[model samples]
Target: MTAVVEQPPAQPKVKAGGGERGLIDLVLRFREAGILGALVVLVAVTTVINPRFLSAQGVEDIFLNASILALLAVGQTLVVVTRNIDLSVGSVVGLVAFVVGDFVSGTQHGVLVAVALGVAIGAACGLVNGLLVSFCGVPALVVTLGTLYVIQGLNHYIAHGEQISAAEVPGAILSLGNGDLLGIPYLPLISVAVMLAVGYYLRSYSSGREFYAIGSSPEAARLAGIPIRRRVLTAYLAAGVLAGLAGTLWLARFGTVVADPARGWELDVVAAVVVGGVAIVGGVGTVYGAALGALLITTIGSVLVVLKINPFWQEAIVGLLLLLAISADRLVALRLARVLRKRNVRHG
Candidate 1:
């Protein structure tokens, strides 16, 4: 009897109840679903308030406007998933846009060169950011903030109070930007392609999964022999490259390129990321969710215009939504914690 009792004690013990863990997983999986539901609700309400909001032309404008922002948000999602931030993305976009404009302004460099230049510039900027954060051990927020200012200043110096006018922009690039496919604009189509590609990588690759591991627990990530610094560097580089791509699109969409286009867009992208269900502290979010958040914000702007509400009220609404998302996340985490505790006590 004594030996049998000792053997029972030697058995492996199960930890937290699966019910709690399962619930948490469900919440995580449904992050994008929740955002989608919210989007549906908002669209339905707006469509009812102003039937014209759903008109074909109105819908086109909304998707077109959201595309650039959605692309930025997708890039931002990658970095945030690794538990980092990139404040300089907007500045990078502005700088790259001006450069691309100057490169092809009066020349026949074509859209391909402009595309390559934008992505290269953005990637270089991201590499710098990643290196500084990874090697120098600087906090991401501080490093990115500094880069933002530096890039913005550099952009002004390069432009020197000059701007790229519509006449200077190449027709091919502009045509590509303005072109549509089967009733869908090019911008949204590009944004969707990028989002789907990145989303697939993050979902399917082991390297991509490491991002979440790092964000969830850096210590554990390190212990598991994951190269935290390299992963982080890659994340920032991807963001910078995407920002560059957006810059190209910006120049194409709005031929009048100025020194400070896309200024102050950092906060907007971050807001979209947060509202899309990506935790600000890191490790939990999908590019899909972020894209949806971007679309939703742009839609809100359109809705406001159609409803004749104060234009400035859109910001207020977005801020409120962000706050609500954070609060909900906190509540869910607390409930999970309580459940784990109860399960432990019961098992004991």
Candidate 2:
């Protein structure tokens, strides 16, 4: 003990800006958290204004209304996550719904056949989009926009001023649309199941993770040997199939088919994607966020109607939300830049 030298006071261990960077990452990574908070606030305020807004019927109506849009948003997420867009989804839905109605309108063509046909039609549309974008290297936006027009034209030409009414829709198909278990509506259930499955795949699968990689940096992904074209093609295929499935579900739920059932809905789907935190420039969002975004929009519409606000205010509100998302994204980017700069200096 007498021979022991006095040790210098120990310096406090530090990870530099670990805590600050962690907080930053948490804020950036949990982008959907903000959306969830907004939803809770919306529900609370609306429920306070109108007790019936929380009524069972009102809740069911909101979920039912949101189901199809949620599905569209899910598929749109796949495309968007790969730094691509699918503007043709709405037209694809319109096309598939009419096709399903035409195929199973009167005869007992059964549920399976009608669904299969719609899915196939959608797959074809997706394949075309994929081929052009992947092989020809055309911009996703341009290819999808062109396909949207073509599909819309084809749908209208096929319908030729005709509509399919509930009476003509098969009972089997309608049953799936309207049926439920334990008092839960099938449409919302199906939409939720689809969202969960896609969400799981995106979060857990290697291929799915590659979608984000591609979106994050196409050139880097190619250097990593990620088969960019194939992944992009598959994304389009999945989107088309979902759109087709949604089309059939659309017919089932509404029991009425028109030449343009989902016309102008592409914008809503994109809005939902953006609102859900999926960057329009690409790589940063989740399907769950997209689904929530869809649900929130539908809920907001219901709330506004209950509150007796001017109908015009709805679109304006949505536009404001979009702007907020963009602004938030900009803020996040700036934060990351600052964080990296600091880390580099500390290591330098």
What lDDT does candidate 1 reach at residue 88? 95
Q: What is the TM-score of each candidate against the true structure?
A: 0.91, 0.90
Winner by lDDT: 1
Q: In model 1, what are the clashing residue pairs, if there are any?
A: 122-240
Q: Which lDDT tens digits does candidate 1 get at residues 1-348? A: 455534434433222247864775577768778778877998899899888888889988888889999999999999998889999999998999999999998888788899999999999999999999988899999999999999999999999999999899889889767888886789988999999999999879988888887887787788677889999999999999999999999999989999979998898899889888888878777898899889888888888889899988998988888898888778877887787788879988
Tens-digit lDDT track of model 2 for 1-348: 579789977543212257554654476458778888889999998899789999988998899889999999999998998889999999999999998898887899888998899899989999999999988999999999999999999999999999999999989999878888899999999899999999899879888888887887787787677889999999999999989999998999889888988998898888888899887777678888899899888888899999999978878888888788878877876777687778788989
> Candidate 2 has which clashing residue pairs, if any?
none
Candidate 2 stretches with Cα past 4 Å from truth are 1-25
How far residue 293's Cα lies from its native spot in candidate 1, in Å, is 0.7
lDDT of 1 at 290: 90
Off by over 4 Å in 1: 1-21
> What lDDT score goes with residue 260 in model 1?
70
